[model samples]
Target: MLILWICFLRGARPILFIDGCHLSSPYKGTLLAASTCDANNDLFPIAYAIVSAENNENWIWFLSNLKELTGSISVTLISDRHPSIIAAVEQVYDRDRHAYCYRHVKENFCVETKKLQRGIRGEVKEDAKKLLDAVCYTHFGTEFTKAVEQLRAFSPELANWLETKGDINKWAKSQFPHRRWDLITTNVAESFNSWIRKERTHSICALITEHRDKLANLLYIAKLEMTKWNNEVGPKIDKILMEHVARSEFLKAVRYGDHNVMVRGSNVDVCVNLLRKECTYLEWQMTGIPCPHACAAIKLLHSNIYTYVEECYLKSSQEKIYASSMIPIETHDMPDVNNLTLTDWENNIFLMPPTTTRSLGRLCKKRRESQFQDVHVYKCSRCDQSGHNRSKCRNPNPEKI
Candidate 1:
């Protein structure tokens, strides 16, 4: 993991996503992870630890080790609004570098809004929720202000709740530090957790070995995959640039200076400053790729849009990230414990599985369905009735009966 961290430091962005997953094994525990994203926006697991639970003490231990590993490099950490994580980050890393995951915020906001409007009439609650989402998604301060004003007009209490929780600079793209780019969620960590879901149930030693093997294979495959890339940037980044280029077709650009231009879309006008790599919409600076407005300006000036993209997104950097190889461990590589002296083996006997209280019910393997997830209803073609498929329908055909 330390070697992986060294490679990541050489090529990956200085952004980290931290999260903890509950282990469902006989000896229950928490799998705390620190992860980052590759140039292609893929998961890059850096470090992990197994702890008894997700408490402040355990989080502090995990983060302290991470801090030592990452050194004093300035990094932006993204995570859910977990109190333990918040406290640990405050104590370990610079508080200004932490950003709350927007997805978690939305989920928590929806749950709170439902409780606040338990018996309210009309669709006011739903409207307020939608407006809150708009506020979160807005990339410009003016648009954010308008959205908040609309929410206030609908419900001042809801607006106030959002304002109290939503620190503009932490969650809003317009005010967020541009170094972290447009990553707003800790999905990179979540994705890595999902990738190792089955392995999470293993014993601590087995889990570590599994992760070692998995990471080795992932790096090897990534190295081979990136070698074939022909573009200046990664595939995902190139696709985004192409999309912005397409959008630039609908925008009109007027030059004011050598590096400044005004781009007019159908309904809005944005100022693009190529020199600073900033646009009035904040997309260019936030994403490290030119927004449609900047794309228009670059096109008008006959400049290479690729030159404006951040160097971290280049294919060469991605290759350098996976250039280091992870040696796979084999059984023969293990030392013979039977040959060890009594003193050597006795001291290691204290290490044991974590202690946890057993729950009352059967352990659930599947995740609980989200409240917002659409429930699919099976329709019976034979009787045109919902909730039962044709094959499972109790109603028989008259002729067959």
Candidate 2:
């Protein structure tokens, strides 16, 4: 909590990826966490709590605790469309900044399309997926509408499901109101969950202390890495800038005014205002990096492209974000109760864990992995062919042809 307060206040963006994962043995509870990205585009965990279950009440409790630190400032919280999470965010924070993770929404879209399939084959569901993918990636309203119309062409019911179940403004990149950058999922938070699986098998104290140690080490590594950065911007931002610079080489920039430049080439006709750091495509504003159009304009004026980037993507911000580190909590000493008086021992009440019944199934200690998600294709050893094992292989017969 101390590190979160100090580092986040100084640097990291006001965007959180909140998620919950089941704690394994020793503490059978749900670990709810709030994490955000740093200037280097890496996972930076803020806070976590252990709850008996993932429900509306627990989620509210978690977010409420988080709200105290965040204060009244609006934050862009990206997560799945969980009913509990949706309800919790609406109550804890304003719903205007709540954005849906595109991946989760896409998974839901796949679900609805599968429902629409209804054992049908050769229905061109791939085309439907492409349309939805375009909608998710597009930033322009016209492009989004065109993509949605294409999706509607595939099936009106499927399109209706997307509109009704998934909010276009929340999940669509072109329509999202906040500065979420390129992150569209809770992947970092989920990575945190998976990273601590072995630690979850230990006692609660050990699990927490281990988390601190890992974060402390990570920060130290980041500090060392920061000294090596050659560019003014963070590594990720530098890569993006160079890529934009290369792409802008094809376009021709014509000065319209003191700050405005009209860029045209390869089907690109857009306006770039170097002074305002804006582009007609809106990519520069949304991503905090100069787009190809803006880069072309900057090149025309012989100005530094890095000057157009937002301050949040710079090395200073990255350093401030990782400046604070957690001190390891040593637990070598344990207070012995043998010297305590009998009266003192009798005065204190120690409560045991609550009684619980094991559910009637094989206990799951990790995430629910779909069996069909990673099916292996068998190859025949005898014939040196694919798709069938040696036992099941039908060897080619020369006489049969």
Candidate 3:
């Protein structure tokens, strides 16, 4: 827990990903975890606890401990729409920001769409799904509205169902707060859970020990890797910036007022304000990285573009996150206690295992497939390739039918 706090405080991002995974141990506890993305967009486990169950009380306990660990720092939390988690977050960190995982929301949307599909015809549901995807990824209010309207055209009932779920701002990128950056999913925490899947079946104390060892090794390697980075920003951010710079070549920039420029794309013109580090397209603000429009404006200014990137993506901040090393607990230093009686050890030193009731079915490790698991096959019309469509087909010539 001390190491968790140290890593979190040293990092520049004030974002947290909270989630719970069911433990496969005989105790059958729920492992509540909070994680974050490091400078390289890798999972950085912050805190975790094993509880008997996942409910309001357990969630509150976990979050309360987390609050104590993180102090009063303002943070943006991302998680699935679990009622217990929602209640606990509101109770513990009322002033902090919260965002739902878009993947979970999309799964729920698919379930509801299927319920509505009983009345609608074929392709309408598919079109609605595509529209929902568009809505989730759109970085501008107008684009989101356009996607929603398109969904409404396919099935007003499905659109209305989505509205009833809650505010679009909670799930849509265009409407989400810029503080969350481009993290719309709780994949960081999910990845952490998968990484610890094998250890999750162990006893509580053993599970915690495994977590400590794994994180210690992970941070040590990360520290060594950070020493090799020469870029101002981390490698991930540099790659993203270079891609944006490449795209900026096609954009034309016209200087406007101080710190403001108009970037003309093939179809649209976006206003880029270097002073505010924003673009009319909203991608720059949403991602904490310069978009193509902002890239064009920065090129015109002849400035170091990486300066516009958020501090969380910088190499210095990344080095700070891995500066602390986790000291290994040496077992050889402990005094020999083999002479102690079993009864005395049980009464004074040994702790009892948690009581647990075995569930009915055989223990299963695989997750059930959701309603969105249907596979869609693509075939090229030009060369009859199975994996690609005609527009993207690599074949230069095709047989005439």
Candidate 4:
């Protein structure tokens, strides 16, 4: 069994994913373990496990081994929020040392909400967005409570989801500012399934052993390629930067040119465009490799924007640096094989025996459900009671009949 985690910036594509695999089966106790991290830009195996015998204690032992490997006092472990994971975290991690992947909860909540709220439109959509935005982007405080109360007025079903005995308390504590529902999901780990799909012809152990090395090799090579590509692209980036500098100067000098006329990078006046969006920096930040608008503004003021933008965030930094600190270091003094432990599931104690075999059919049964929930079910506070939300929830009392 394997558990993988993908962590990403909210509203940004994922760039970090970690995976941990257990060698044992639910029915038997043979336990093995391994883990890897993929930045998509590169993949590296951070840890590995070898199960010598059948024991259920292997899972917890394997995780304990991982804690040593990870070297973090407070690790933000994210997964599908699997029941086993929740139970495991509670059992192992001390308070405030673990967090449930709110992303998974939001995903389930969204799916359920959509099923309940059907065919909602216009202001209803806006209201639903408000409620979700409240949870995703607001701190769990008075404002968040207000947002939830707002949703209650929009739809009874939504109000119930927020207020459910099991949900409200948990959701409140898990809430954070600037987080988004889409930020959650193990999609990055899901991507690796394809990597091993064609190579799964062998049994589980064989598949893992073979691909484990293969993945390690691939990651090493990928880092090298990323370095080369980043260097290769440097000249192109410099050229673009130079172009922005020239354009900014030309735009400033020319007063005779029509504002709407076609001119590369000079269409808008730099001084009068007060809205940041109307400025060049914001525009180029979105469409160009570097902030050409910042480049232009720099040239217009004879200031060095290069110094302002950190080298780390520069396009030039595309080359991934596989810091030796990030992975295990090879030292002669280090044991050829580190400490190993085997656990017997029956007694939850250490034991040793030959590896046992179980059918992969059981493994395939636990695949995640692929479904997108309705968007309407997450209604706004204004429209909670009636079919209509705040924008459309007119106070129409029936005539005195």
Give lDDT for model 4.
0.44
| Pairs clashing within candidate 3 | none
Tens digits of per-residue lDDT, candidate 1, 137-234, equal: 78867888998899888777677877786565677655565456888888898898899998888887778788888889898898887977768887
Alpha carbon lDDT at 84, candidate 4: 52
Reference-based lDDT, residue 268, model 4: 46
Q: Is candidate 2 or candidate 3 better by TM-score?
A: 2
Q: Which candidate would rank higher by lDDT, 3 or 4? A: 3
lDDT of 4 by residue, 1-401 (tens): 11122111111122223333333333232223232332222233333444544233544565576565445434444444545544555565442334344456666666666688787665776567557657644432665678777777877787786566324433343342221222234444444544555544444445555665575566467546556533333444456556766655555332222221122343443331212323332333232233444554444444454444334333334333332212333447532223433432444343334365665565654536544434354343643563555565565652321
Model 3: residues >4 Å from true position, as ranges?
A: 119-124, 333-348, 358-365, 370-401
Model 4 weakest lDDT span, ten residues long: 3-12
Minimum summed lDDT over a 10-residue window in model 2 is located at 348-357
TM-score of 2: 0.90
1-401 in candidate 2: lDDT tens per residue? 67776798788888899998766655477788888878878778888987777889999999998888889777889888888999999999889888887777777777787788876564476677778899888868888899989888878998888788779888788888777876787788877787787887876667767877877887888888888899888777788889999999999999999999999978758999988888888888888889999999999999987778888888889888888777766656744567667776687533223233456899765565533258687866677667887777678752222
What is the lDDT ranking, best to worst? 1, 3, 2, 4
Model 4 stretches astray by more than 4 angstroms:
1-43, 48-59, 94-103, 114-134, 137-147, 163-183, 229-369, 373-401
Clashes of each: 0, 1, 0, 16
Question: Candidates' TM-scores?
Answer: 0.89, 0.90, 0.86, 0.48
Model 1 — TM-score against the truth? 0.89
Model 3, residue 376: C-alpha shift (Å): 12
